[model samples]
Target: MLSYELFFKEGLYNAEFIKKFTIDFDLLESQVEPYTPEYASMITGLSADDIVTTAREYATSSGSMIAYTLGITEHHCGVNNVFDIANLALLTGNIGKQGTGIMPLRGQNNVQGAGDMGCLPNQLAGGMSLANDEFRARYEKEWGVKLNPYPDDTQTRTFDRLEMGELKALYVIGENPLLADVHMNHTKTLFEKLDLLIVQDIFLTETAQMADVVLPARSWGEVDGTYTNTDRRIQRVRKAVEPHPNTKEDWEILCDLATLMGYPMHYHNSKEIWNEVRKLAWEIYGGITYDRLEEEYSIHYPCPDENHPGTFILHERFHKQNPDIKKSRFVPVDYTEPLELPDPEYPFMLTTGRRYESYNTHSQTRFYAAGIKVKQTEETIDIHPEDACSLGIQDGEMVQVTSRRGELLVKVKITEQVVPGLVFMSFHWSETPTNVLTLNEYDPISGTAEYKACAVAITKVS
Candidate 1:
């Protein structure tokens, strides 16, 4: 929407870059014509003039980047939202250069690493598709076992299957679904229904407490591994102190479990496991050996050979190297309203996010005394002063917040940070469990739950 406003209205786009690198320029212009500044302003509540100014600034800037978090993805139209952002970047040619490109700020330190290692159901290592015959055959040959060509169930699908009694067991690692997942009541119920629930974590989290078998895993300071940051930089981590006698390294525990089963995973240390990763996913990790990582301290991916330097900026030479190939395309995405909207009954919109002092679900942060004392001792719903005044609610007052899914008692924080008819809360407190009020609606493409937007009613507790 903003890109179209910049292109047709303000004429503030890189015509040379668009003509050389992209396709479907005419189609994109036509597709986005209807999304005027006024039209977008109506939906987003930002003034038309402000939207136009923002578009102009973004287009005219020498180098600009869009960095977003779960606020953009935790919606029913999350995938489309991302496409829209990418379209804007392509429209203004603000990508494939220094200080430019779209960046999704990962929530955790190693989320990028986990995804690169094929944590997602649909992808194999190095972002390869599971349905790709060549990729599947490579994995099968390397592992000496027949591989399932089809993609496995995602987290949302697994929950659906568990509700229907199809999935009998679950192995949770470093996650607290009871506090983190949307519709917490339903998630807890599904976990209870599971025949075997194994939770592996350093801390005995709320989810771990319910597990039939809880495997104690070593913490970050007591583990030797590589952590890939949000910028795709893989840095090695060394064990600082000895681990507890009962706890074990996450991979060692998994290897032991695998050995107990039919398959035998004869691995020694983290280096051996990393070497196996390099062997299997040569395209991305081929040159990223422990030796190189030790010598260089850190390196980004796409280092296909030992001598090849890591990729600093992606797609930098794509247009020059692959002249015949179109570099990118503008994906036209129409704006869609959130799944749930504020009504008379549920007169406010509740958006959930994280606090600086506390991390997701407060699994690790809560253990630190200094962090807890410095900021965010407990969870509180942040409401606009207008909403609080209208309801005769005071700051720090206990309130009852209810949505269709569930209700919880939380302290109130009257602030102008949030707009009228909108409230904000963090899902960092297990006691408050803000996800109890979150909706379970997910994006069809990404399967990310609608955690950012939900309808709720907040009332002062008598």
Candidate 2:
């Protein structure tokens, strides 16, 4: 493992802070052996020489950055994986500076924005802790209402609540959980049990098909809003076309629904809603206004006031002086095996991801003629040539992939991108329904399903 010290603006950190954090770091790292290049090679299947060379370069570099995507989060130990990444940054003193620190590529556009707008079940806008008394008081003052100290269940737990008849209704938007969530059959059963299932989207997705009420919402081109990209750049999304005659913006729909339910929501337009967000989430998005978005094209959050230029690099001092902040603490984590391991029966590891031709679940991209032409019209499993030969499977031939949960017959694309004992498939086509074969085991903390690794057996389709 790499060893380094904490830095502040080219100078060493305060002696007291460094000593305390060093003890904490040492205690955490003591739980496991140092990850030497040989150990990494054994675990990751990379060459030892390459691993050593890469480690040397990474450690000796003036500034280094690490970025990852769903591949890191879509695991049974997703939260721990993130902690380990953070630990690496801390060890190397690569944080709180430009061209350094960690970056997690969002799975979709506006995913960061959604969280910033308080879409999570546990936290309020700007990542204010719902459980914190001070955070609640601040939001209550801004919202003019008492806030719920205890947050509700996460999306993963909704199915459990529905199964127990505790959750009677669900309001889904922009996501097709039926085709996207792990254990597709189980998700479908839970949807069937819901007393009321409401879906709002631009298209009738598989989940919408089962909804008791489907509300058509305006598409991106028809709505004016802001989308925060993976790097925290909040960009304006102006209406480029009129919404469909029968549809309206999602905000308008929600406002109407809230008013009808006797909880009146008064917002003249999207801008009004954004202004309220700015008032409440002043810590992160205070400086990002609709007017600024139009003028600058985009602005990063933690923008404190109107005159303050939007911050590009975050954690200038690593949240040292901000209100309601605490000194950073070292979180040590150890590696764990995947929840589901390949066995003699299921001898191959199956991993799912996106293709360039399609976005998540093909909500919109499938209909694009050019995208369809660029990729295979249907779902195909990517297999190494050696694995296909052993299974008597030919290139472009049909193969049956079976897990304990379900099975699918898909065309095979023999390639070297995947190792011999592993297969990769894009979960983009409804026809293939890849989620059916994915394990339902999820990270205990993040509740993100283990879509990156699962055990499945493959055979040539007769």
Candidate 3:
């Protein structure tokens, strides 16, 4: 089989690579040899014996599922990491079948839906690229509006633009950038300079407190809408109670704002908006109506018509439908060390992630009784017992963790969960905001910050 290593060796990314090769899966597989378990063990930290056992088990199994969270996508090489996952699945023939798939566990409830509806800066609804002439034309005809023919700057670039005075206004919805953004000090400076900062959310978040306008929107229980889950299941949410006296539903507020801005958005209710969404992206959402949702509870996307059942596993007849494009291609990537490394001055590696009790930024979770009881009110840094002892820090003692950008005071939890040279923290509390110490460098393709790794130095304060 043509292994990815052979594909790279054949000058696939060079000027003459495409002209010299064809996209034939069988031909390419035959030209290259698959890597042995020992080779994989060299790159990953896993032992060769464990790797061999895992390889055997996976190959022998009828179906297997691979699931990962931000751990796989919160690095400088995040995009390539996802590509590596896809390569593994394709090589093992473990996709597009029941009981087998590569699933990304989203951080939030509707994150998958947001991507499908084209919340990305580079694409329109349903991930239709503005750069694609055919896709752009079709969307323009369907929406009766002309979209920018070029991709817009990503959220990272947008912040840079705000700092540079290139952009003035920022309308934030359901996000608390002050507490959540990498390099919290820098993010604060950028937000302060914006001529108009509008925040729409259920609570007065740290970011919302700084905004010129804070529009109070109804919470989940007071709104009626459809939510798409990580598995692409479209499920309906009904109103359990009326909205607060001062608060309006998110859609109603948005529509009223649009009307005032001369767009003339006159939707009577949430279902009217749903009908419009169905009309705009019929292939994925046509059969998913509120009535159908009441009957079936939920339906996965690619539900083309009312009579059609929702797709469970995707790509059943993919190769048959598109002989050339349906099959997978092997793209080779090289591993690079993280941008920041442990130096003599900052001789510790820092990683940040979410905890079971606290969600991102704690905009709402901190208010929950269960979330509060699961952990202490303040955030604590998890450090190895060896590191804590070496640094003269005891468990429950306060420590000052400093990075190149900024620093924060967090409590020390001496545990063996982390390695000797590494420490971990979650950005759940304002008292010990971990983002202040995180580096601002992000993945070039996905524009996601490198939150998984950075260099830091810690000093015991107590």
| lDDT score at residue 38, model 1, on the 0-100 scale | 88
Cα RMSD for candidates in order:
1.6, 3.7, 4.8
Pitting candidate 1 against candidate 2, the one with the higher lDDT is 1
User: Candidate 2's residue-wise lDDT over 1-462, tens digit each?
Assistant: 232221222232234434433347555546545565566676778887776655556655777888989988999899988987776666566677777889999887889889867889888877678999987898788767788899887888777778888988999988999999998988888999888999999999999999999999988899987888888898988899877799989889988998899878878887887877787768777788887887888888778788888778876665255544445666877767778889999999999998886888887987786533574678999999998889988999998999999998999999999998989998889999999999988888878889988999998878
Stretches of candidate 3 above 4 Å error? 1-44, 132-143, 318-325, 370-372
Ranking the candidates on lDDT from highest down gives 1, 2, 3
Query: What are the lDDT scores of the predictions, listed in order?
Result: 0.87, 0.80, 0.79
Q: Model 2, which residues run further than 4 Å from truth?
A: 1-23, 142-144, 318-326, 370-372
For candidate 1, lDDT tens digit of each residue in 287-328? 988999989999998787788888878878633656675568
Best by lDDT: 1
Per-prediction TM-score: 0.96, 0.92, 0.89
lDDT (tens digit, per residue) of candidate 3 on 393-451: 88999889999999888889988989788899998898788999999999998889999
Q: Candidate 3 clash total? A: 5
C-alpha positional error of residue 457 in candidate 1 after TM-score superposition, expressed in Å: 0.9
